[model samples]
Target: MSKEKESVLEGFKAFLMRGNVIDLAVAVVIGAAFTNVVTSVVKGVINPVVGAFGTQDLNMYSSCLKAPCETNDAGEVVKGIPIMWGTVLSAVLTFLITAAVVYFLMVLPMAKYLARRARQQAAKEEVQEVMEVSELEVLKEIRDALVAQRGSGRNDPGRNGPGQSTP
Candidate 1:
């Protein structure tokens, strides 16, 4: 292949091999699967609870938008305009249920855990900083003492001070 073509292919391969791309693909697959579960829950559990008051299926509910709204033998709209508000209601309920489940079960717990970890990390860093400062203070004290000792030695009678020549 030409170098240009080869470079393009290599770039595509590198993009596909990236961790974020792989993670996104995995998330998409898992999300699709989770959606099915949520849909089933809405249809099976939520619908039945609402059914106690009216129709079991939310899709069955509707209002006549125009006059002469009628259904044929197969329950298909054969006459006037009908607004399928029940379907919209069902979709809204499904979305709310999904959001609640994701928030309470996943987002909330993760947020709490991250907050706790952050607090712990901050405390650890504070302790480390204090220790470093203590060590630095000790080092400074040691350096001062060494300087004092050297100065005293120079002042002694046996030791040469500054530029004085030893004869």
Candidate 2:
């Protein structure tokens, strides 16, 4: 009934508020923005450099099975089924560039940073352990000293109390 509906809405609210969901949402938004930059670089810089050596646009390069691909204002098919190999090549190149940038700029650095943090945490733990061991050693020494005093009768309140002199 209405109780089930309320539970479902509460579950949905919890899902939306989860840290992973929020992180994923942020990452998608940032990725979209980054995609635009990468696309611009591919179109503006990389494409032009590649075009200098070959065709003006890589996307324009294609293969026609019918022999003639480009036609001059004819109502008929210009060429065979044009397989746009150039566009595919362009897409592949863009993918490679994006992967390389993300790896080097984000993933690799994040991995290095995480490793460094882990090392630091390990070192801090070691220091704490050493300090704890030293403290334990001091505590044992104090305990042993008190035991020795008691055995020697110096710790006895009646025999060698702080205010009374031993006869």
Candidate 3:
């Protein structure tokens, strides 16, 4: 393969291997599955609760925009403008519920965890920097002490050099 094609393939491989990309793919799959659950809840639980005051089926609720709104025997509107507000309301409720659950259960916790991890990483870096600086300072102090001792020893007549004996 050409170098350009090889590099592009390598880049694509790296992108696929990234954790966030995998996470996003998983989320999409799970979201699709969760949609069925959310729909069931809205249809079974929410609709029944609303049905206490009116019809059990949310799809049945509607408002007449025109003067003579009517539906045929097959439940299809044959004349006038029939605004199906209940269907819209049901959709809105489902969206809100899904959003609330995802935010509270997934997004919020992940955000907090990432924040904590970042703080911990920053603290660890700061400690490493401090340790490096302190180690350097200690090494410098030791060198200075050794130099001072060597200078003092050389000036003193009592201590001899490496090969010289005291006369």
In TM-score terms, candidate 1 sits at 0.88
Q: Which pairs of residues collide in candidate 1?
A: none
TM per model?
Answer: 0.88, 0.82, 0.78
* Residue-level lDDT tens digits of model 2 in 1-167: 69999999999999998999999999999999988988899999988998899876888787788777666575445556777899998899889989999999999999999999999999999999999999999999999999898787865656765556866
Question: Per-residue lDDT tens digits of candidate 3, residues 1-167?
Answer: 99999999999999999999999999899999999999999988999999999998888888888968877898788888988898999999999999998899999999999999999999999999999999999999999999999899888899897886888
Question: Which pairs of residues have clashing backbones in candidate 3?
Answer: none
Clash tally, candidates in order: 0, 0, 0
List the candidate 2 regions with Cα displacement exceeding 4 Å. 70-78, 154-167
- Residue-level error in angstroms, candidate 3, position 65: 1.6
Which candidate number has the best lDDT?
Answer: 1
Q: Could you list the CA RMSD of all candidates, in the order they appear?
A: 2.7, 3.8, 3.5
- Per-residue error for 88 in candidate 3, Å, reads 0.9
